[model samples]
Target chain A: MQTELSGQLGIERAVFGFTPFPAVAAAISRAGGFGVLGAVRYTAPDDLRRDLDWLDAHTGGRPYGLDVVMPAKKVEGVSEADVEAMIPEGHRRFVRDTLAAHGVPELADGEASGWRITGWMEQVARTQLDVALDYPIRLLANALGSPPADVVARAHDRDVLVAALAGSARHARKHQEAGIDIVVAQGYEAGGHTGEIATMVLTPEIVDAVDPLPVLAAGGIGSGRQVAAALTLGAQGVWLGSLWLTTTEADLHSSALTRKLLAAGSGDTVRSRALTGKPARQLRTAWTDAWDDPAGPGTLPMPLQGLLVAEALSRIQKYEAEPLLGTPVGQIVGRMTAERGVQEVLDDLTRGFEEAVDRINRIAGRSGPS
Target chain B: MQTELSGQLGIERAVFGFTPFPAVAAAISRAGGFGVLGAVRYTAPDDLRRDLDWLDAHTGGRPYGLDVVMPAKKVEGVSEADVEAMIPEGHRRFVRDTLAAHGVPELADGEASGWRITGWMEQVARTQLDVALDYPIRLLANALGSPPADVVARAHDRDVLVAALAGSARHARKHQEAGIDIVVAQGYEAGGHTGEIATMVLTPEIVDAVDPLPVLAAGGIGSGRQVAAALTLGAQGVWLGSLWLTTTEADLHSSALTRKLLAAGSGDTVRSRALTGKPARQLRTAWTDAWDDPAGPGTLPMPLQGLLVAEALSRIQKYEAEPLLGTPVGQIVGRMTAERGVQEVLDDLTRGFEEAVDRINRIAGRSGPS
Candidate 1:
């Protein structure tokens, strides 16, 4: 396929979005595009190490990246115990009551379901970074904020490029200023935490602001035409996150997967602060509705809100709650109706990209619309 | 300029956004574009007539279009008086108190500040449509909904093509089924009322679903690269609304103009239902803050919310209150730092399109990033 993003990654054009599973990541890199493994949810360094080892063994030296949820707005000197202590009795009771009302049984003594290991805090993410750099990773991407200059320096020392997600051109500029090698200009329609700017506008603005530094267009990007559109917006490549949620290689919880598959349309996702205490877009469910209701307890700031809801997320997964289960998804979730292997999805994407290019080339000499 | 949209419009690739002012509409047409004047805000037929007369005198036979706020979700049958009655006393008091706190003065008796005219009610928009068809408009675009079948039939009989804005591929299919000549796939980041999907993903999906039927990519579109991106998304053209707010020819209320110009970045705007009851993206202001605040009374629905906030908008405009005055703007507002004439902006757009094409042409057959 004739594309800039593939050229940048030294791969053929493929379905290039994020997937949290190591198997999917390895398969993606082998398929021709970069597969980024999200390490934020790994509570143990051994788990992340083993995952990276599995990827290294499977990919046969194919390049991939590791993503960590490193936020620019850091909380200094707060221990996990302090954070736990900060959770109000009323809020704790609310979580317990809500789960109980949903017929979710409590975990047995010594059963591991604590949300504290999600690695959202700066301290936890730093350890995850240690695990990431140990692998033959080509890139290290930060999710919510600029990578610390020291971390950028460290990544460069290892000859690994650093990437960060920016919701606006200004944030992209900040990312560039912080020595980020790549800026992923994620828009409002993206999974996880996103900014208000749409990808169509934000991608080009980021490209302009951080010229010479590559920009990967995120948010609402999945299909081959969307990748072509991102290139048109001056992006080096396109980032896909939510598209992979339905992939066979994805590690989606069964209940969340069911809810995603049965989603009505793109309108099913809402920008709710209930998840992780940030305005992340996710499929609307009974849980989200309860949290967003006026009579219900409102959300707290990042880490606090996420800390508060971690038990509920665990219970929902443990109980396999259907209507209450949700996942961070883009509006593009509607297109992900069926399960497909990573290579199959990539094949379709590559074909689509080439076709879109052909479609544009056909109109090269044409003046305007018919 | 060598572009498909330009050839389709029988003009050069030039200004391709919204036309809120008669001068802007006339200037856009003169600058090699098909400018569609937004008539939803005109409370009086005479006002719209005068605007059309002005356009006719200035356009030098160039064609233009008219846009009205016809929403698909109809309010059955309700008079303006009935809508007025539905506005709660509490909501009215909140509006009054908020405006008074901002030191915004009241509008003079009988002076027109028509928030009522900009509602999505079928009855309110039909009157505006009647005024629009009286003019020599070539296109009639609806803002929120499908144009009624009878209205579509009538417009087709007169050879005046009807267009409707769709937020999703399903909505586009519906528009096509209802016989809309053009489908404007407006993304979530678009100004005014928009859906959750971003333009990058939404545009191509809509275009694919409704092939041969022209799709205009709206929301977060303004810059040259964005137009190219939209075209890449398989859109016939781009429809921008926020880009015109700072143009020299645009009829922006001065306070809004200042706020728009001084906007720091894309993060400044918020999608709030405070102004029009519908979740339209606008520059974040104290007014939006109060409505979004949990301590304050929450927003009402459609016409009632518009009615409640009408007096406050009038006062803000009357007193030229910069902090309180907000306008429907997309995330692209950050890029609009300076005011330029329609022709200057159009020249930039044309040049940018060519430059983008050249950049892509250079990428053809390229192996990897430099």
Candidate 2:
């Protein structure tokens, strides 16, 4: 379906978000859909700059976006020591003991205390934003909060749209108030941090609450039928994350790739705060179960939580600990059965959109299911 | 869109489930869609018979269905006394003290023992089934588990359809293997007991899993656009429950109606095991919060949990405790802004369905958003 959205972004109905592979983004964009690189893990400004440089070289003349988390709340004006001090001793012990129990090697003394996480904080994200604006980026999306007004204005100067993810109508309204050009209504069934409401209800509410601003429906959507449904629910396009993990171009760890293709179903995921400070939908692994149990130490908030857990997870990833390695994924994982090329996935989505439209046309004619 | 489903049932796309008011079911059927009465509360066979009699008289020859819970797992061969004895003393105390703290009057001594919950058990459910079959019912739906082979055969003999509610693809497969006529894919966003997967992902999975068996998408679906989305996702029709609660014909207590219209939103409900032994989505209230808290006694299993909490809840309902009384509802509660007749609601659904088809047709034409 060639809506005004496609006319502007020069894409079909699909929009890929944080697909864990930069090459997939270029291919999706070349296939006539928006492809956004997830930047929360990029860490330093140069990391983003290097990725954008490579993306620029690969994509012919297609447009792409950059996504980074910049939450409104953080440990402001505090030293790394002060932030570390905020975590309780019990939580630290639980993390250490549990990883050890799983046969994960302990990091050398100074290694675990590497760089403290500032992903969601405005200051750290701004550096990523500055590097992002230097590229031929068509959009900039804040995954955790509204893009800062000044940053929004700067992106506007570059003719780049600024999108923000909202879990509710109230949050969407706040995004609109803060000058967001688009609202990605991510729901409970989505990977990463998600709100409690499901997409079916949340999309229409957000669409109605902020009528003028375009909305992209996300979460539990990974098919042509779902893309059609999102369009029916009044979204400008479908924003996807989890579906791309099993794509041929996806830069996934060998263990994660095998497990995703073999073991995951719609019910295999759980929304837990073990990986991130906030409740993010992820693969239900031994790590998540242990963190969720009563005897385990409770999770810390925001930056502190990331600082505590990411290292252990990185160690597990290195070892390819399949039972304990968890990745952010949605309920749509059940439908992602293979390692198809990105072009093939986009083609399927486009065909699904067309077939759905045809079916709907038949229904409107009072015959139905033609 | 009038299709095979509408032609078969002779109505618009909405299927009302457990609307509380028998008249609403009759009226919905009168408007042309099939209506199914939720028989979870009708513990006695005669009670179901009486309700169906009223429904049959009022529906003017329109077909309707009956839904009863018959979970696969139940306390086998246990007497009612034994089942009641199994509820932990702490759970019973928590139920009583918490309600008392909220100024709810305790049920008179021995009043709480009026009916032992045999909802999930076969014996109690068979009585309702027996009564249901005696009528001109078009369908019989098992709300919790796979319908028995004998029951499926019996329903087939009567030329009536046997449907089972499924929360996953595995459950849908089980229903199909059991010779179920239809599979109702009810997602987590639905009211009452539901699985963790959201409807958007669950509907398509169930549809694909039980290909020949028709699916009725349920949970977080109240509008015609949602109906269109469900159909697009490969459902025969949409199964609805929560949207009917605020209708003009609904027989809700005045205080509950007031709260539903004034206070409920997409985010105002929680999936907690407070009311049932399993997690059921209901309006969030102080009652649910207290039960969810770690300090409180954890929930008991199935009938035992129901035995512990239902009496206190019924007393709250009788007293019309607006702030504390929680009702089974979906996240779509946010769109339900006013009370209206069943016919008007159906009309809206029909119109929305047509408009959605038109919109999709426009997209298919590649003109988009006209």
- Grade the docking of candidate 1: medium
- Residue A286, candidate 2: Cα error in Å is 1.0
Predictions: Cα RMSD each: 3.3, 2.5
What is each candidate's DockQ, to 2 decimals? Answer: 0.57, 0.74
- lDDT string for model 1 (A1-370, tens) is 4455566567765345577888888888888888899888898899889999998888767789899987767678988778878878887888888887888888888887744535888888989888888877888999888988888998999999899999877788889889888888888888888877778778888888999888888887777777776777787777888887777887665845555554646778888998888799888888889888879877777778888888778778777877778888888886787788888988887666656655554444432222
TM-score between model 2 and native:
0.95
Which candidate tops lDDT? Answer: 2
Tens digits of per-residue lDDT for model 2 on A1-370? 7656767777655455555468888877887778898877766788778888988787778888989887655546876567677888888888778778878876666664332355656667878888888888988888887866788899999999899999999999999999888999999999888999998888888988999888899998888989998888888788898888887788776656456544688899999988877899998988899888887667777778887776777777766666788788888888887778888988899888777776666656643344
Candidate 2, DockQ to 2 decimals?
A: 0.74
The residue pairs found clashing in candidate 2 are A11-A32, B11-B32
Location of the lowest summed lDDT over 10 successive residues in candidate 1 chain B? B361-370
- Residue A205, model 1: lDDT of 83
Docking class of 2: medium
> Against the true structure, what is model 1's DockQ?
0.57
